[model samples]
Target: MYGPVCFLAPAGVDDPQRPSGGNRYDLELMRELGELGYPVKLTPVTGAWPRPSGADGRELSRLLEALPEGSTALWDGLIACGVPDIVQAASRRLRQVVIVHLPLADETGLDPQVARELDQAERHALHAANATVATSRWTAAQLTEHHGLPGVRVHVAPPGVCLAPSAPGTPSGGRHLLSVASLTPRKGHATLFAALGALPRELPWQLKIAGAQPDAAYAAHLHSLIAEAGLTDRVSILGPLAGAELDAAYAWADLLVHSPEKEPWGMVVQEALACGLPVYASDVGGVPEALGHAYFPGETAFERPGRLLPAGDSAAWAEALNEWMCELRLRDRLRTLAEQRQRTLPTWRSTALEVAMALGGFPSTPWHTELEAAPLATS
Candidate 1:
């Protein structure tokens, strides 16, 4: 019998204004794991994670001590990676597993010294853990290269998508564009704005941005760019929408524009696909994996639901957008491909099962054991 899992997550994971892919993954996994018959003891830790205060460290240490000896402790990387000393101390008695959505050092705009310190801390913490789980194959590879962690110990548990009702796009399909990412430099909002501004004024397209303004300065910069380009009327910055509201936004959009400078895995991409909306995303990190490929039956030739552009290349983005706007044939083909792709998306149950099998090899469940040979879930 599998014992209860001590699941440690960062606080504010449910903040409507700052909903993140990592937070969503954690929440879904918790729910689905419970449904799959695992008792999850959840503890949402409060602090500036990955750089918490001394008191925060004390709180975490106390919490770790409170767990029963030899318990299976599953920690979100944000809560565990920054405190190597505490993690190493706790490792002696607990079977600790760290789930990394993204490496702490990989966040954009960090000072070199700070990045190095975080990297060192993460390396120590992950090394101290019994096993490490990454969200994508790319992220798993990065952990190995960045921290020299053993590939055998690192497992990939990619985020799953709940299929939504297919979007009913306009007849010509280039009227609405959606971007769902926090307003940060890392998300490449500046690049996306620049590309939009370069499009001809006569092109019929409006952009709806649904995300929180996490970085005030960057948010301000994006607003100024929009105004300077005389696009204030055409662009709407809706501060984070969820549930039915987010679903409505996806349904209204004809295309999803995701241009992150660096992404571990784009949950939004899969979400868009699930809704049968094509994507125009930066070809970086695990985005390609999330986007996957749409197979054409009876033909070996495959197509992606949308285009992948060079990261940070505003000119390339502009060119692609212009093509998408002008070519009805291209739009029709991509729309059909998007529908085809939607049928193949992984479900939350599968995601939770993969994670469960990784953390504790449920040998009695023969089907789950098959995932042990192929740890990374193919998109």
Candidate 2:
């Protein structure tokens, strides 16, 4: 009797109509679920995720007023999460579910008040949901371990990726290494630059870092650092890589690297892997869980994050990059290994089934059982 459900997220950026990172992910799945015979609705936040708009209160009010008595509306990002004093009174009467993508606690540089607001709201969302899902066990553990929720109660649904099929050899042979991450401080682009500074010679490869320039001040810092490191000619800051732009970056890259300090679940890692490219991700959050040998084949899987100086050490990040760039045989071997791993990787069809299960009434069919029992028996 759960009627057609809705997936709510910060739909767009400041414009409210432009699609952002997680918004695209949520909408894509919503459409696929709808096509799979479930009536699915997408609700946008007044503005964007992490940046709640006054429109948020209005949107929640609209959802409450519009939904029929017993239907559910599932929220898709961190913004919709914190059911605080504001949201507690605002959304209390509604039937809701929350898919915890990443909590805001890791935004260590944000205002304390903002962090507290998120804390209060997310806890309440977790408490009130008909069900809440965590994209990784790491996140579920954080909630359960800190918030006192039963870990088993929160659903764990691994993410899925859709990569454009590419002819690997021709596309990946160009002279560039690609790293995709936001402009946030935690993403560690500066470290990669510093690491590159230490190389004896600038290899023929150039490094392209893509994502929106988050804050102007941070962008200024990166610009200064790159100039100081003498990398203006070798490193390019390509703003907001999406769709064909991102595909072309992938199509022209020699390899991929991600060095984020606050990566909860890296979507780009999966995208790169699915594109038949290799990845060298920092050792943090769910990156290793997604790319380690357990889930990926031997060659394609990185040797987990090694002692690259420290987590945010730019000099150390450079060392890793330099070493990785020099190892052609290793990269080739891993690329082959990844192809084998793709054989077991989950597709959107399987991801949708898992999502359906988390929403309660989804059945325990063969698809469900297979997913329930699967995972790399990693130590």
Candidate 3:
């Protein structure tokens, strides 16, 4: 059994208006930990994190100073990794355990110098932690190779998917494609639009993008691009959906098209598969792992449930979409594969249990020992 634990993350993790995979994971884990009888206290840090201002730094410092010396603090790497000084100081007092969704430096569209600085800061902060938890094996490897954190005890606890009824698929004479991710550069919305634009205009399909517009300028640009490509009628930008609304969207979708430049673990892919919706995603990061397939492009021997194309390859994405749409047999085969894979997904309870065990250094857990001994996924 673990002692009292403090969960620290960005301020808007619980905000329903801006739902994200990371936010959902943090909220669910905290709830599950509490349900499992762990005394978990959620402490949200409010600020423009990863690039916290002077005031944000002071506030974080105050919060850290007040925490009990022996307290186990599970810090979300978004805030903790970027603030090396603050985390390093807190590590000296608190038992710091960092939960990294993705490395800060890996975020797309960062200036080279800024990325380098973030990499350095994150490396320093992670080195100071008692242990580090990665959301995916790819991220764990990245921490070791890219951040120079070879000594840190890194634990891999992937995000779990909720079992849901299979989607009914496309309506008669209509095909629906769904892309679930935040409207950010990292998600590669522009790349998706470019790929969609290349597809035949007469194709009987509609694209629905469900995500929050965190970047207003980027959102506007997407809207403009849609109009310019004469895709305004074919596309609908549905703001972030949750609970029943999200479930309905998944149920209605024929295919899940994700074009993120990079993902630590694409939670939406698992979610899509759970709903029996075939995924056509960019082959990046831990996406292949989530799809239950290895990244073997151009290898006909590997029977992939869905097509995983090279990231940022608009022409390849267009070609894949064209083939999937025009060939009924291929679509049916992919959907069948998705349905088969859904049964093998891990539950949220298992994820929470793993984290709880990790917090306590995997005490008395044979499963944890086995997981540790298993070969880590390679890039």
Best by TM-score: 1
**Per-residue lDDT of model 2, residues 248-298, tens digit only:** 888776567788877667777777777766676777777766664523343
For candidate 1, the lDDT comes to 0.87
Candidate 3 C-alpha lDDT tens digits along 1-379 = 5689989899989998999989988988898889898899999999888999999999999998898888888888899988989877886788777889988989999999999999899999988777778888888788867765542267777889889999998744128899999999889878788888999878888999999998899999999989888899889999999999999999889999999998999999999988978899999998988888422234445466788888888889989988888888788778877787787887778778878766775422331323343232110
TM-score of each: 0.94, 0.83, 0.91
> By descending TM-score, how would the candidates be arranged?
1, 3, 2
lDDT agreement with native, every candidate:
0.87, 0.64, 0.83
Top lDDT prediction, candidate number = 1
Better of 1 and 3 by TM-score: 1
**Which segments of model 3 are wrong by more than 4 Å?**
171-174, 293-302, 363-379
Task: List the pairs of residues colliding in candidate 2.
Answer: 82-121, 82-122, 83-121, 191-314, 195-318, 299-334, 300-334
Q: What lDDT score goes with residue 124 in model 2? A: 69
Model 1 C-alpha lDDT per residue in residues 1-379, reported as the tens digit of each score: 4688989999887677678899899999999989988899888899888999999999999999998887878899998999999989998888888899989998999999999999999999998887788888899888877787666667778899999899986767889999999888899988888898999999999999998887788888999999988899999999888998999999999999999999999999999999999999999999998999997555577899999999999999999999999999888888889888999888888778767866673321232223344333111
lDDT of 3: 0.83
Residue 216 miss distance in model 1 (angstroms): 2.5
Worst-scoring 10-residue span by lDDT in model 2: 370-379
